[model samples]
Target: MSIKINTYITILMLSSAAFISPLITKGQSTSLDSSQPETVVQKKYGLDPSKPLAKRIGNTPPEIIQKFRDAGMSPTLHRLSKTDSLKVVRAFQMLPPLHQHILKEHLLGISFLDNMPNTALTATVNPEDQFPVFTITFRAEILKQDVSQWLTEKEMSYFTKDFPGFRIAIEAGKLDAILYVLLHEATHVVDGSLGILAMDQNKGTSGMAVNLKSFTRNIWVDRTSICPSYTDSLTSQSRFRGGGRLLPMELARQIYQSAAKGPFVSLYATSSWHEDLAEYLTVTHFTKRLKQPFRIIIHEGRKEIFIYEPMKSATVSSRISLMKYFYAKAGSSVLYERHVKPGGRGFNG
Candidate 1:
């Protein structure tokens, strides 16, 4: 779409802060009390301290068993409900053979539950749908008791600002927060299983549109920007001025190009598209399936991150027209084909 690449870069750097935060140890106890001020210990050796214990174990598969032993904790993966565990396993078995292999290769041998002195949290997968689902549940009373121990061990005040909500939640046995966090991470695993993250190996000129057959829809790129006059009108209003609204199509095109310039996209469009599409699909699918309206809340003084939502009005004829516009501007074929089946469905990768 011939965007000023520099402008796009600026937007990305600014917007990343809100959506991207340093990973926090998922299962670790934190002393977030007022006196403690939520201090974080940065990981040494490039390890992600925020990863779940099971993931940490999985990451260094062979060493995990030894590390747990050395630490003198008898590590046992907690099993939630037998029925739920069976359902999750059956769901995994029902996936396509290749996907099953991917799941086993990537996620097998990982523990789904952790037991602490006073509390326990167990992870479970729900596979009763088209995609695999992961969840975590906590034993409320035990979790609070454990949290109290954590705070005391860290020598932190219980009344601190950061600790208030967390302490209250833990004491009340409100597991929704933990549940949401697990759901978010589990979504990542599901995306990978669906081959939504594969890379397109086809080498072609810049600005060429690549058909992503795995998505069951054609992603079209067109050379267009929001009408200057319309953008000017929107900018005059403080509400829209924050990020400056653009036409939905134009916004999508800008994001597509910006993502194309990202690290993974250089080596493989498919892989890059996987993350891009995952973000897109998550936002869209959540809105549709959960009935939550999509909203982008921007902080004006801060940097901007671009959000793209596919057009509900998009049609094959309209997509063709958009492709032609880019083809004419690039003066090249500007089209790389991926196979799609009739009835608008196909394998993702």
Candidate 2:
């Protein structure tokens, strides 16, 4: 991802138009990390911003395959089959208008990678550029599973090993995995667009002050670290926060107890403020608007040891009211499924 070339394209096409004639709801999707430098991920995978969303669905880029090697994982590019492609497109269509609007405006393209353990989006960020454009890369297998199966697999990555009688499960029912992932990634888009997390902003440059966003105010000290009041040494040692080894299953109960007391929704949310925003929005929407369950079952041998449902926490509820910032511009109710459009337009984020 050459910041030079893409900056030219984005500045001329996207930034110029968006700023000159701003869209009703605006922003970019995904976090920053240019996957391949040979050519932009959008062009290599046949992504044309001029095309409609459905037409944009196609093969994964080779750069995505190479990116897995950085993590020592060998993943192949998996083009979407006709049936899978429809499911992917449908998932995008189901999203709220704010989400739809953000992706439609700045998404260069989206693709899949086989053998990839998780879903991710990469961006080429130039602080001078207001709207940082991005492309999404998903793990191809997600197309086959519902939200529960997908989330359970993802949530289990926190632990060292998964053995019988000592396991964790996410009983989130049958919401489509693609829908959940897209919504989750889209929140990152909102973060990038609204400067919600400030990770890609010019704050890191010397003499530049870090002013935390309203969403991150008391929770995060900076993009990578949380406030001391919210930080606990135990959860800090969990896999996601630079802890080398995974945690033991025996500590699941203690983990949930500490997490429930914090502003965080999940252990993974503790990874950073960027992911914190993503996980927060994803869980709230999944359980509230979608009317689904998000339960974490930690089992010890044959017995259920601890169950932590984020939706019920007082700390979690505090964040829900703040989510209105995502859609409040249109004066729509916070976290509601029926996204009202600007003035009187139809729901189309």
Question: Which candidate's TM-score is highest?
Answer: 2
Tens-digit lDDT track for model 1 on 270-313?
Answer: 22233233234333333443344332211122443333222232
CA RMSD (A), model 2: 10.9
> What lDDT tens digits, residue by residue, belong to model 2 across residues 1-349?
1111221111101111111101122322222235422135345534455677656555554554554555466767787788887888788777766676656555666777776654544443222233445566676788888988877876676675645568889898796888887777776655444444433333341111122235677787765678899988887886556554466667777878888888888777887666776788888877777788989988777788789888898887787866655554333432122111112111011
Candidate 2: how many backbone clashes? 6
Over 4 Å off, model 2: 1-50, 61-63, 69-74, 125-129, 162-164, 199-213, 328-349
Compute each candidate's TM-score over C-alphas. 0.27, 0.73
Error of 1 at 167 (Å): 17
Candidate-wise lDDT, in order: 0.26, 0.59
Model 1's C-alpha root-mean-square deviation from the true structure amounts to: 19.2
The segments of candidate 1 whose C-alpha lies over 4 angstroms from its true place after superposition are 1-76, 81-110, 113-195, 200-274, 293-349
